[model samples]
Target: MIALTCLCGQVRTELGKRPDFIHACNCTLCSKSGAHWGYFHPSEVCVEGDTKGYCRSDKEAPSAEIHFCEQCGSTTHFTLTADAVAKFGNVMMGVNMLLADERDLAGVEVRFPDGRAWPGAGEFTYVREARFIGEG
Candidate 1:
């Protein structure tokens, strides 16, 4: 299992298997928040802590919700909307790399999604190379 925790170790999560995909987003909130995206099946994961959800009605797509830790103001995970759940049971976990341990990211793939042009709602670039097996 891949374990994830907040900077202060107040919040914790266990990912049952390697993520289906990992991504780095350059969107306004993502870039400012400094989180590495890890996508997985929500049903295969377990979380423990005080987490809060935030949604941006103006820019959010049909299947995504941003989640953050209340105590440390750290973005922790993102859940897919109903549409996405029906299509792919993938939940995006916004892992705080700084807090992840080496064993927590074993066998994980990493990619980059060009959320930089989120303002213009342009196309996004997803990298196929690059993977993370340990804490960053």
Candidate 2:
């Protein structure tokens, strides 16, 4: 199990197990927020504390809602929006791997998928190749 906590200690999430992998998507929101993502189902994780969520204001129907710490403003996790849930049924949740110790992430692969040009419903074009968390 792994635990992720925000800088202010106001929000915390416990992942039941190690994530399969993490993504570093190069998109407007992700790029600006500086998030390294580890995806899982909500059942695989437990969250505590209050977080404010933000969906893309630029899109008519944003797919996911980004969550952050209410106190220190640290990006924590994301859940699918209601519109997205209706289609996808809350199948995915994303945690900010940047909150964990690098050593804890050890051999997990970090993928650089190009979300900027992603079609939003299919596989993404990888702008950069994948790398393990600890590679020299």
In angstroms, the error of model 1 at 76 is 0.8
**TM-score of each model, paired residue for residue:** 0.70, 0.95
Over the stretch 62-86, how does candidate 2's per-residue lDDT look in tens digits? 8889999999999999999999899
lDDT of 1 at 111: 66
Give me the overall lDDT of model 2.
0.91
Q: What total of clashing residue pairs does each candidate reach?
A: 0, 0
RMSD of candidate 1 to the truth, in angstroms, is 4.1
lDDT per residue (tens digit) for residues 1-136 in model 1: 7677887777898877766656666676667767777655567767799889876676546556677788887788777766667776554444444446756556666667767654455667653446566535
Score each candidate by Cα lDDT. Answer: 0.67, 0.91
Clashing pairs in 2: none
Q: Cα lDDT for residue 126, model 1?
A: 58
- Tell me, by TM-score, which candidate is best: 2
Say which candidate scores most in lDDT.
2
